[model samples]
Target: NYLWINHGWMGKKVKYKEEKFKITAIDGGWSKWSPWSICGKDCTHTKTRTCDEPAPSYGGRHCSGKDTIVTNCTGGLCEN
Candidate 1:
């Protein structure tokens, strides 16, 4: 409990605590995509990339659509 008086004027005193925090924003970077995988069942090929190039850090944004990608290859007929 406290009070402040200035020029015969009285006012209630307020208490406050100060806080400090640091935040660094980093955008994700991607590495080169690996070579296409050999055709597998259904003649499908897969390729993938990683964020290790500069992986997201300290609440940084992740690379958009960083998921694995599967593509169809020619002459890859699935044999029952």
Candidate 2:
């Protein structure tokens, strides 16, 4: 199967890989990495996680890289 990065905030949707994954979102400059949520509706300025690795136990395992992962700008954006 073919897969490509899907950007929901940009309304860019495409067919995804068959493998299971978890999607997350970050601001524009943070695209290459993950942003930490300092609080509800707020995020920390310190950049810790990168797109190349899983997030630090935010709760459970989340998709980090191209492992069938898609990036979205909202929590309810991607279907999985």
Candidate 3:
């Protein structure tokens, strides 16, 4: 649940400053309302998925085979 304290959707491109937010949990799968995942470099692995297993970059919960999970796609690889 996010609180849009101040609405900046209509602002100009230069006025916009992107902020990093983490996806605490997933609601089954990534539909339109999938929470943003941005928890440092360490991603919280689900119970079914082992810690040794690498998380997929752009994949849903029921993903199979080798997947690529980009950890910091939201705010870039390095924090500025």
Best-fitting candidate, scored by TM-score = 1
What candidate 2 gets wrong by more than 4 Å, as runs, is 1-6, 20-80
lDDT tens per residue, model 1, 11-60: 55555555567878777888888898877778788889987668888889
Task: Write model 2 residue lDDT over 1-80, tens digit each, in one string.
Answer: 76877787898877777776775453222135345333322221233434334343434444434422232333432233
* Residue 19 alpha-carbon offset, candidate 2, angstroms: 2.6
Compare candidates 1 and 3 on lDDT and give the better one. 1
User: Compared with the true structure, what per-residue lDDT tens digits does model 3 show for residues 1-80?
Assistant: 33344447955334344678875532232222224444443433211222223333333254343333443343433343
- Scored by CA lDDT, what does every candidate get? 0.74, 0.42, 0.37
Clashing pairs in 2: none
Q: Number of the top candidate by lDDT?
A: 1
Write down the worst ten-residue block by lDDT for model 2.
38-47
Once model 3 is optimally superposed onto the true structure by TM-score, how far is the C-alpha of residue 72 displaced, in angstroms?
3.6
Candidate 1 off by > 4 Å: 1-23, 75-80
TM-score of each: 0.59, 0.15, 0.16
RMSD (Å) per prediction: 9.0, 22.5, 21.7
